[model samples]
Target: MLIKMNNIHKSFGTNSVLKGVNIEIQDGEVHALMGENGAGKSTLMNILTGLHKRNDGTILIDGKETYFKDPKEAEKYGITFIHQELNIWPEMTVLENLFIGKEITSSFGILNTRKMKALAREQFDKLSVNIPLDQEAGRCSVGQQQMIEIAKALMTDAKVIIMDEPTAALTEREIQKLFLVIDSLKKQGVSIVYISHRMEEIFEICDRITVMRDGITVDTKNIPETNFDDVVKKMVGRALTDRFPARNPNPRETVLKVRNLTQKGVFHDVNFSVKSGEIVGVSGLMGAGRTEIMRTLFGMDSIDSGDIFINGEKRTIKNPHEAIKLGIGFITEDRKDEGLILDFSLRQNIALPSLKSFSPKGYMNRKDEQDFVDMLIKRLTIKTQSSETNAKDLSGGNQQKVVIAKWIGISPKVLILDEPTRGVDVGAKREIYQLMNELTDRGVAIIMVSSELPEILGMSDRILVVHEGTISGELPKNEATQEKIMTLATGGQ
Candidate 1:
């Protein structure tokens, strides 16, 4: 199938999201939709898939004007969208989720469980996913859940598939497997609209690229004809210097220390320490207990046995409130679920952690709260029309900025960042890195749990590799290499 979008315009309450974006997807090719956060890439896809109506545009499929009434209609027309957010039903079984609306039924309207299972199994096998169909979807790890979404889309037998940040939660091995599947799909004459912030993956897998900036199409080029520098320049409309900001560490006393931290069956004796102004990077394969360890430290989960020390004083933290009171902050990995309340305004979310300060007299001072929120929005460069804007209205990168701004308001001594740059664009990622540098300069100790090896190597003063819920190896910034980190992460001696 060949897809074409011309002069597409989209808006929400006078906010112009897409202002004349144009792109064409060829049959049997992997086309990349590249842009900075809030650049209208996802909105364009939403228009094409019938999630949102384009105010002014023309979409052609097979050289004929086509507009799907809804996403289901698009799916039925052999177009499938695997969104950036995994749409797994937590309470439903994996099998049920795979065939939620499109279930198999018998002649008498009875459910055909046997055939559904067989089809689901076949799709999972094609993706090399090992998840059990009967298991609760919520119990699976983020990476496993991502695989389930991929399998669900594949089962649609889609001629055109739109994948947005599909490999964000996947491990190296899983990424390789996904690439293999993409190659196989290409051979079968399927078209893939790949959307990702990871430039490496785009250059490796995509055939052609279309970049957008400020809701307008900037340029489109073949993968062989373009370079990383060129694409980033077009997306941000500026030249980006270094990928990571310089971190000149001046370590003070240890601000946070963990000794023999255990979360029962979840993680084993995990021990690490972070000095003031130090970035202690926690690197490992997905589901290797990195985020679990951080969650326990931030009092999100109960610790079966562990010793936590803040500024040389041992403390018992039973919940997030207690952790916050003790000068600790956590930016969770699952931003949609844990980081921000989608319905809340930006001011409300940013002022949540600092409510005590804003309400010292049992009443919030509106001016003070607004000023604080404004300062953070400007500092983080969060692109929003106003502080009263709903958190869900902003793009993914802006939502992440809001999450960071919420924690930064509390002025915590130790901050735990889980996948700080997970789905963020390159420019926003650099800004975040620069902010990390500024925070450390203020003597804030950071424990960053990241699955991206390059990020760990780029920003860390010290790196700790976790293998099987244990600290397999620790290396200083100078001595760390990608191969060494991967080796230790895989339980190497």
Candidate 2:
């Protein structure tokens, strides 16, 4: 074995995060760490990487007992951790960012830029990455940033690398590229700990699986020994016979229409319509103008030439307030930043959009606000100490539920969900799927933008594939396959 952690225990305040969790990794294998958001996965990894002090545990590397005092010590022992959030200086160039803390220097203490950049280029080329080293790191796309981060790890000559949600922001092609990189690393006998919510990638990449629940290691299985359904059952302690809820069998009249929607450089000739009780999924790679089109429809951005018809009425929506008045709600991609006020209480966030309903005649009605919040909390199954609890205190799943509850209270005619299930656990994803089913059943037209092919294929009544600021193709659920969507997204006929 390359690494081993036994009887790991950790606690913060009075809450115990890990309870005797155990994990082991062999050389040259991609080991998957599976768990819910708060199921102690991060805590255990933090302890191993020396970010947090474990209450009790034993760590062994190369058949020798060892203790890592800090991240530097862990790195000294040939271990590296790549955080889910890309840790890079936006202002620095790619080569400069890679050698941030540990820069090559001459005997006179001057930077050895020539040697460092040559080494960086070698690492990038090994991963088949082609970005210029002199370019600003932040100017590159998310996938490019991730590849650079991995190359930076290789720059350290790390024997073991831990990647947390590396593909969260990557497109299908980018993900395939990353898998190739991983394969190359495995050939070099590097051990990788892969953590992510996407199940397909886990099955495809990992050699073995270790499931964690609450604070303990539930089971570990080889890739061929266990299946997706069994893994989901072990992780969530329940059986999900179907990941997605039943799709709307019949869609009614068209509730919204976009006729030749064009936003100059952003998107051109984008035309799509959503009918009541229908889920119209927008599928494309990042920068495909999906998000821009959604923002334009939601009145966040202006359209150069187009007409929007809502409920058979041609209306010019100048802003979100106008869109809201016209019964439209948009749940943005970054829920923490765009959807909810982190410092505010759940009740406050839920009542923010429709506060006027409770504050009739210039007087605030406290009872009405309380009653509304109470109803939503119970109805949406938002787990919290109380409605008065701060939004930041909830888990990723709960926080997302709060975002959905806030919009559900408004009950818009058109609900636009941009990457609705991003950063959420499988259980929460299922819950959100159920909520979408309920909304469509109540005649709410939905427009969902997703990068996950399975999500689009599972939940959508029809899919709109975008390619470089244009709608390349539209696919029905029956005809939509991952390969077909990828081909269309890449501008195939």
Identify the candidate with maximal lDDT: 1
Compare the candidates by TM-score and give the number of the best one: 1
lDDT of 2: 0.86
The TM-score measured for candidate 2 stands at 0.88
Model 1 per-residue lDDT tens digits across residues 1-493: 9898999999998899999999999999999999999999999999999999999989999999999999999999999999988898999999999999998999999999999999999988888788889999988888888999999898888999999999988877789889999999999999999999999899999999999999999999999999999999999999998899888999999999899998877888878889999999999888788888888888888999979999999999999999999999999988888899999999999999999998889988999999999999999999999999999999888999999999999999999999999889999999999999999999999989887888999999999999989999999999999899999989997
| N/CA/C clash count, model 1 | 0
Tell me the alpha-carbon RMSD of every candidate. Answer: 1.2, 3.1
Off by over 4 Å in 2: 63-73, 88-99, 102-154, 343-350, 363-398
Candidate 2 worst ten-residue window by lDDT: 138-147
List clashing residue pairs in candidate 1: none
